[model samples]
Target: MSATAKKGAAKKDGANQPFIYRHYDQEKLRDALRKMYLIRQFEEGAEESYMRGLIHGTMHLSIGQEASAVGICLGLTDEDQITSTHRGHGHCIAKGADVSRMFAEFFGKITGYCRGRGGSMHIADVSTGNLGANGIVGGGLPIAVGAALTAKKMKTGNVVVCFFGDGANNEGAFHEALNMAAIWKLPVIFVCENNGYGMSTSVARATAVPNIADRASAYAMPGVIVDGNVVSDVAEAMHEATERARNGEGPTLIECKTYRYRGHSKSDRNRYRTKEEIEEWMTERDPIEAFESQLMEFGVIDQKGIEDIRESVRKEIEAGIEFAKESPMPEVANLEKYVYTEQA
Candidate 1:
């Protein structure tokens, strides 16, 4: 059965209605779903190999965080910029990174994007305008703010998308970054993927603010909260924000309320949550499945088309695995390569 079939019937909610500014076409929505599937399958494959000891390092998988990544990326331009998170493979892929090379990075092969230097947390594709994914919490936000400032100065009109988790929202850097972006009217959209929990602790325990978006007012910008599991809603929100930014408006804070199915990292047994909780979210709130249902309702893709996409993703993943396996490991003497800028 397809992953969509595994989820129970979705409940009707106000969040299900299409947004006024939703910028999704048949091709765009289909590509969004395809990107989400690519991230999901890649992370699942990475988890399996890591568990089998084939993957050597620690990995922060984005198993349940697909919509925030792909949905937001859907609104990005080819020349636009983005900063990613510790769980960054999804961001990389959504920003147009090569799947084979992404896998090769995890395999520690020389051909990996970082030449096998940075693992799952730090994969990047500069040509795609993905600045880089950061392993440190709140690290990317300020960097994105800087990028936005540069864009504003250059009068480029290109927006910068900053992807950070709910945990990073509490960081001092988060507030500072937003404040700076707001004051300067920088073309930056701060996306908070609030997946219920930060590491093992639920958002309730870690955050006093009821809504992360609500805090945007303090920064003197618009704050919007949307169902993160619904790709159309997120795409709408991001679209609106980017347009406003390009028009010389300020930044917007978007809180994407969603869930993560797997443990914080592969290391945790997920003792913080119950099986029932996981099952509930999985059955009702999976973004990929939710988007698939909407696509079918709109006749964007039928069963056969969905299956074809699944098969295509699977074959592509398998090909990536084979390529990574055949790729050579980086030379020992090149340990310090790509780490520092070369002297003139």
Candidate 2:
């Protein structure tokens, strides 16, 4: 069936709302759904592992922000690069990192991407164009800019997508990187995942401006806002920004106004926000639920399809955990191998 016709079939209350991929191909929509499901399931499994004392250190889960990661990465090519924040599993997975390796990293195994030393917040897969996830709030900004600058200087067509939280918007690195990128017309896209709270403090109380995107003007670049909950919306924005960068027009700042369904990290008590607010985001504004409904409405998938995807994701996560369990721990002999380098 045509994608739009599929949407018509997924109606509720005798009305048909917009589907993200109504007019697009079904494979693309299906792939997106599968990726989102994988991210959600992986994070859920990671949480379980953490609770079970299998993973050391706390993790910042991106449980509700799958759409932003998948959407933005959809606009990037294999040659393109990305930098992620501490809550970055979704980004790594969406950028084509192996789930087994990621799980091994969390388990601190020698087979992991960072040889098990970086742990949860510092996963890096250079093969997939992921520089690394930064533990510091805004640490990845300048690195992304440097990557873009190198690409620009070398005349490479690749661009860099830098993902940061709203909290990073207030950092000096953000301003410095943006200014340099704009002036040099660097191939970079600054994506701000504004998930409301920056470690218990709400954005309203933290920032002077209403929207972080507005600050892009000071750098002489186009600033756009997208519904971070809608994968298609984010994809469109990223596509525009990426195109602008590839065309030598300069960097673009995209503010994705999203929400986190979980606490900021394992230690977050969630005291600053009420349960009602989280419930609203989880039940009503859930990106996965909304996308599933739209897919059903468009006849792209049914209950069976959704269940199948969930089951497959579950199995994949289970296999990853098993692999992690079987992987060997990092030996003491190589403990300082990657920690420091000899000066040239």
lDDT string, candidate 1, 26-142, tens digits: 787788889999999999888887877767978888887898888788878768999999988988999999899988999998888888988788888888989888988999999
Per-candidate local distance difference test: 0.85, 0.89
Query: What local lDDT score does residue 259 receive in model 2, on the 0 to 100 scale?
Result: 92
Q: What TM-score should be assigned to candidate 2?
A: 0.92
User: Against the true structure, whose TM-score is highest?
Assistant: 1
Clashes of 1: 0
Predict model 2's lDDT versus the native.
0.89
Q: Write the per-residue lDDT of candidate 2 for residues 205-254, one digit (tens) a residue.
A: 99999899999999999999877887877887888898899999999999
